[model samples]
Target: MQVILCEDIDKIGVAGETKSVSEGFARNFLLPKGLAYPATPGNLKKWESEKHLREIKLVKNLESARTLAAQLESVALSVPARAGREGQLFGSITTAAVAEALLGKGFSVDRKTIDISAPIKTLGAHEVTIRLHSQVEARLKVEVVSS
Candidate 1:
């Protein structure tokens, strides 16, 4: 039996793909679980149109991510922290603080998206990576200054 997959099945096929399977498997497992639909002429036509729309949406999303990445790369953030006579800070700069600083600059960034390999403890320039999208990443300089 031929069926169009609605969702990706491990070892079988991905979503929006047509695959051949046993009649029993198609009727019992794929149909009952709503994982696939029988590939009739009408269904094939519907899937083609839906596939085109999905491609368009993916292109738009990629463009948007690239734009955001460019904007983020040019931004330099300054974070103020209380420190002693030396350059050592009383506390480390957290991901939440970075997100807050970005929010202050009119960019609503999520703390989870900011990747800091280690806690910032010194008062100097540091590199921070922001995962804006799966295909896009932006690196920005974070300057920590004593308040």
Candidate 2:
């Protein structure tokens, strides 16, 4: 069956894309979920007209992501925590903590987008990765100080 996707589906296709799939799958999952519609001639023409708008929106999003990435690169975050004499933190720093710190700095970032490779149990400086977009990433400098 031929379908035009209204939303991006993993392992399938993106929005405004036309694809072929098994009839049963399209009718049962995609159609019922409102993720896609039958690829009729009228729908195809409508998609062709709206394609330019989608492209423009994508370009704008990419530009904003790049700008955010640049700003994030220049930011240095300090997180104060209770620590022992040996520089080990009483508790580990979490992604929620990092997100809160970023929010205090006037940047609204989701905690899920922040990636820390290991548990921050020691007090020092560490690099964290923030995924702003699929094509843009920024390394943040986080300094952990004893409170």
Say which candidate scores most in TM-score.
2
Q: List, residue by residue over 55-85, the lDDT tens digit for candidate 1.
A: 7876797799889889987987999999888
* Superposition TM-score, candidate 1 onto the true structure: 0.67
Candidate 1 displacement at residue 21 in angstroms = 21
**What are the clashing pairs of model 2?**
none
Q: What does the lDDT read for residue 76 in candidate 2?
A: 87
How would you encode candidate 2's per-residue C-alpha lDDT over 66-142 as one tens digit per residue? Answer: 99999988998998899999999998999999999999999999998899999999999998999887668889999
RMSD of 2: 3.8
Give the winner by lDDT: 2
User: TM-score of every model?
Assistant: 0.67, 0.74
